[model samples]
Target: MGVIKHQSIRSTLLIYIGFAIGAVNIVFLFPRFFSDTQFALTRLLPEIAIILVPICTLSTVPAISRFFPYYASHLKDKENDMLTLALGATIIGFSLFVLGTLFFKDAIIKANIEKSPLFITYFYLLYPNVFLFSVFGVFESYSGSRHLTVFPNFLKELVLRLLTTVLIVLHYLSWINFDTFLWLFSLLYGVLLLALLVYLRRHKFLYFNFRISRVTRRLLPKMATYSLSLLGASLFTLLANNLAPLILTSSKGLQDVAYLTIAQYMSQLIMVPQRSISAIGLPVLAQAWKDKDKDKIEEVYVKSSLLQLTYALFVFLIIWSNIDSFFQLLPPNYSVGKYVVLCLGISKVIDMGTGLNSQVLSTSRLWRYDLYSSVVLLALSLPLNYYLINHFGLIGTGYATLLSMLVFNTIRYIFIWVKFGLQPFTMSSVKAIGVALVAYFGCIWIPLAIHPFVDIVIRGILFLAIFVTLVLAFRVSGDITSTIYSAVNKIRRRQ
Candidate 1:
């Protein structure tokens, strides 16, 4: 728990730095520098890469978390080289990805050309984008397995965005045209992969002990089954998260997809705390499962839920409370996305409330349940997104997401409870929700006349003060209250 807390705090702070850069890029720069179509293209390209990450990495990321403990114990035997196996598997998976893209290129273009014809010119960039990120994802998992999570977080959350800022600046300076900017933007992932490769090599974790002959027949089948199940689980999870944007690209148009992308970014900002914890927690959870320590796992699950609910609700209220002022800061062209922001913000809040349910199930013997649950959720999401987008447009996509996530998280929670006797709920979670609602409603009527920047700052500070005071007054979460006081005491001491 100490390690989880330490690494999570480091990663959370790093993630927030990344979010600040991304906010500047998405909220300010993209709207200012790129046309709606160009912005949509930028959003769609990385989205395609994200979609392909699990496929091209052959589920190696999750495989690392689930199997690295076993492999670590066998390192002395030099037996079953997990790194070599994962790398070999990734190469084969990437080759398959390329072949599939070649085969389906026409179908893919045709599907998207109607609403997002701008994508046709940059279609070839998709493979390299996926390749780079897939490799990066594999290494990130490997690093996490070694308990070196902070470096990858730095690369992903800080360095990548910093490089992206440089690229955007170059484009704005007219040093590069739009086409070159797109090319360089796609190449950012390639640079990221190299950076991680160098880091791993320097740490001496890049050993290529391909001792495949030493693997037992029993272990081979088990590894194969786990990898394949994780592959399904990862694919379905990506689909549930990303399919709506792709569907919007096809059904609504590039402009609408651009709108939804901004909303998604805003919503994902609230998820940083949970994601940071999960990145650091998965390895711990896997080790716990290996030791058969259900108590430790349950402790993590409950504490993670309480802490995530506290942080997520605070972020949600801040985003929603300042949404009008925030959007006003953007160009009028992006005004339609306020509803998109609101609905997706609620959806993310629901997701963050579930804490690490997916991680718990994925790292436990019940991992295969994730595949089944994700498949059902994906099935539900597709039709709902399609129908809703046709009837209600972009905001309907948010509605579909919210509904699917509510159902998906509910199923996972029930499975965890019934199967493992673990339920991540407490009176503290209830109190946090109560505090958020009160803070939100109480601040909405405070008044608004200043600049959007001033308005957001005033409203945000007021909301935080009110929410913090109430939570502390009610002792909603001791962990959160202690953290607040710790920061205050540190400030006092410095003064």
Candidate 2:
């Protein structure tokens, strides 16, 4: 528990650091400097890459987890064999993508490029970025299985974002054109891939031992099988997340896509804590499942849910409270998509409130349940997105997302409750919600007596202070209180 808490804190800090850089890039730099077309290109490149990541990685995450314990045990010759297998899988996956692209080149070009003349030339940039990002995902998952997450976190949350920021600045200075920016993105991904390879080599985890025993050979098929199942869920999840942007770009113009992108970026801030918790939770959940530790699983379920909701609600309030200020920071034109923020915010809130239920389902033997649910959600998301985006434009997409999240989270919660009797919320959860509401309203009402910014600052401080005080007063979980005290003591000691 101590280790998990420590890792969670460290990961959260790193992720927030990354988020800060991302905020600058998305909120300030990109929107401020880039034209609507450029911004759309920026957003579209990533969506394409994310969609391609699962296809190119071939669901290497489950394989990495399944194999890492073995590689760790047989650290000498077997490490090389694992590396060899990973490299082989990556190459095969990439080759498949290339072959598919070649076969479907006309359709791909026509669908993505024909409509958006600005993105036509840069559409090819998506390939390398997607390929490298997918490869990085494989390595990150492997590092995660080894309980080595910080470096990957740095690469993901800090390094990549920092690179993007630097590139954006260069563009601002008129040093790099949009084409250069797109090319740089691909190159940056390649650099990260190289860095990962170097790290693996330095740690002696890059080589493949060809000492293929009968057992190891037999395990490959099983690994491949699990990887496929995991891939199905992963692919569907990525599609659901990115389909809105794809549809928006295709149906609407680049300007519309740019606005929705900003909204998506702001909404994503709400999920940072959930992302951090899920990162640590997945491997732990996997191990617990392997051990069949029902108590540990239940403990994880409850604690992770509470903690995630706590942080999520805090972020949600902050975003919602400062929604106007957030838009004020953007250009007047960019602010047109303000409602997209509310729509996406609601979706993320529902998602975070569910805790790490998806992680639990993904890592448990009940993974198939997740696959089924994900498929249903994906099916629902496409039509919903198409309908909403067509009728209501970007805000409609947000509404579609909210609808999808509602269905998905409700189903997951109900299933977890019925099968495992593992409800994430208790009376304390209700108390936390009450505290949040009180703080939110307090912040809103107090502002009536003051200016917006001043009211925001004062009410924000009061909200946080009062919220903490109430949590302490109610004594919701001695562990959480102790953790708070420990953190305070550490800060005091440092001072």
Candidate 3:
């Protein structure tokens, strides 16, 4: 429990730093500098790479999970075998994807992608990005397995974002054209790959033994099988998540897609902590499940839910309360999709509230359920996104996403509850929600009495005070109270 608490705190701080950097990129700079079509490209390109990377990398995650325990024990000998298997799978996946893209070139080009012809060029750029991202996944997975979450967090959340900011600045200064910008974007992945290589070399973990013994050959098939299955699930999930943006761009145009992207970015900010928690939790959960530690698994589930809800609620309140001001910061044209922010924010809050059930399931024996659920989501998402976007534009897309997430999480919650009696919502969960509502409403009135910036600052402080007071007064959780005391002591010590 103490280990989980410590890891969660460290990971949370790292994620917040990442979130701050991401906020600047998404909220302030991208919208301010890029045109609608450019913004859409910026968002969509990454979605394309994210979708492709996991598929190409295949079972890198499960392989990491399987090997991490061994790798931790035998760092010198096993690192090369793991890296060989991971890189080999990545190459094979990339080759197959590239070949498929070549054969289906016309179909892909005619997908009504944003910027049409221009977007097709970006597909080539995705190759390098995909390769680098896939490789980095191995490094990240290795780091997670070793309980070194902060380094990967820094590389992924901070370094990558900082690079984007630098690139944006370079473009602003007339140092790079849009075409060069695309290339530079791909180059950033190369930088990450190099960085990971350097880190591995420094740690003496970058050797490769191409022995191809019977054991190694045998392990390859098993790893490939696992990767393929995980890849299928991942690909479907990506399709479900990105289908709306694709539909919106096809039906509405790039401008509407841009608006949807911004709103989606705003909403996704709420999930930063969730992502952080999932990253730190995945390896730990896998270990627990492997050890058959049911009590530890349940403990992780409950405490993660509580912590996630606490931070998620804080972020949601801050975003919702200052939404108007937030949208006001964007160009008036971009502000049209502001309602999408509210809808998507609600969806993410629901997701965060579910804790790490999906992660636990993904890493446990019931992992096949991810593939089934992803298929269900993909089936539902296409028509839902198509119908909604055709009728409602950007907000319709949000509705489609909200409905999909609601369905997905509800099913997951039911499955976990029925299978393990592992429900995340307790009486305290209900009380926390109630307190959040009170803080949310209470902050609303503060805005009426002051300027937007001042109102935001004041209300933010007030919301924190009220929320803490309510939680403490209500005696929400022994763990949370102790956490607050520890944090306070740390602050006092620093002072």
Candidate 4:
């Protein structure tokens, strides 16, 4: 918990910094510099590749965390075959993907040509985008396994986004055409991969042990089984999540894709704490399971729930409270995504409230259930997406995602509680909900300022004051209070 707390906070701060820069990029720069269709291409390309990353890496993202404890405790880094097998699987998987894409190239074009021609114009660029993304995914997981996540996160969340800002600016200035811009955009992942590689190599945590050691040979069978099963889980879940974007691009065209992308981005702003916490959580759970420390795992589960929910609700309120103002900062067309933001934002808060159920389940002995959960999500979400999107359009996509996530998290919660006697709620959970409601209602009727920025400042500060004060007074999380007090003490000592 100590390391998780320290690193998670650092990583969370870094993620927030990235989000700040990224907000400017997505909300301001891209929209100003590119057309809706071109912006959709930028968004959709990454969507396609993110879906491909897990399969291309053979689900080594989770497998690396799951198996790293064993490999590290038993074998030296030079002899550790975990990374070797991970990279090998990625190479093979990516090769097959390329072959398949080439074979079906005409079919893919046929599907998107009429609706999303801009997407298809740059379709081949997905190869570089997904491959580099896949490689980075594997390395990032390995870095997290070593509990040295802050630096990798800095490169990923902060540095990459900062560089992206430069790329978009270059295009905006007419220094590079869109073609070259897209090419460089795809290659940014390559730069990110190279940076992480250098970091891992310097830290002595990365080496290609293609020569399978005795220990690795013994573990290969289990690792193989784990990776393949998790791959099914990863693929199904990603596909289900993207069903809206895929259907929109094919049916409604890039215009809707643009709206959905922006809405999704807005909703993701609430995910920083959850994202930061979960990144370091897997390795901790893996080691806990290794030592048979059920208590430690349970403690992490409950604390993560409280801490994540506390911030999740806090951020969710801040965003929703200022959503109108935030949208005002964007072009008028993007305002259509208001409902999408609401649906996804509420859904995200619900998932964060459930804590790290999925993370713990993946690292537990009940990992096979992780696959089952994804299958369930796919089954529920596919029909929901088709039905709702047919009826509601882009906002329908948000509703579909929200409902699917609701059921998905419910199922995982049930599974974890039934199997492991572990649930992530405490008394603080209820209090966190109370805090959010109070802050929201307390601020909702406040009239908007003439300027959106001024409205945001006024609303954000009022909400923060009410929320943080109540949270600390209620001791919604001792962790939160202690951290605040610790910071205050440091300030006092410096003064």
RMSD of each: 1.6, 2.3, 2.3, 1.1
Off by over 4 Å in 1: 77-80, 213-218
Better-scoring candidate (TM-score), 1 or 2? 1
Ranking according to lDDT, highest score first: 4, 1, 2, 3
Which ten residues in a row are the worst by lDDT in model 3? 70-79
Q: Of 1 and 4, which scores higher on lDDT? A: 4
Q: Which stretches of candidate 2 lie over 4 Å from their true place?
A: 70-80, 202-204, 211-215, 446-459, 477-479
Total residue pair clashes for candidate 1: 0
- TM-scores, all models, native as reference: 0.96, 0.93, 0.93, 0.98
Candidate 1 global CA lDDT score: 0.86
lDDT string, candidate 1, 38-62, tens digits: 9999999999889888888788788
lDDT of 3 by residue, 1-495 (tens): 667677767767776787778778877887778777787787777777787877777757656765455444544554346767677877887888788889998888877654454567667877777777777887777767666676677777788889999998888788998888778877786787677778767876666766564445545676566667777777888888888777766666677777887788777778877777787787788788878898988988987887788777878888888888777667788778878888888888888988887777877777778777778888888888888888877788778888998998888888888887788888888888888999888878853544666656777888889899998898777777888888899999999
Better of 1 and 4 by TM-score: 4
Candidate 2 per-residue lDDT, tens place, 92-164, comes to 8888988897898788668757457787767678778777888788887777776767777777888999999
TM-score of 4: 0.98
TM-score of 2: 0.93
Clashing pairs in 3: 59-227
Top model by lDDT, which number?
Answer: 4
Q: Model-by-model lDDT, in order?
A: 0.86, 0.78, 0.77, 0.89
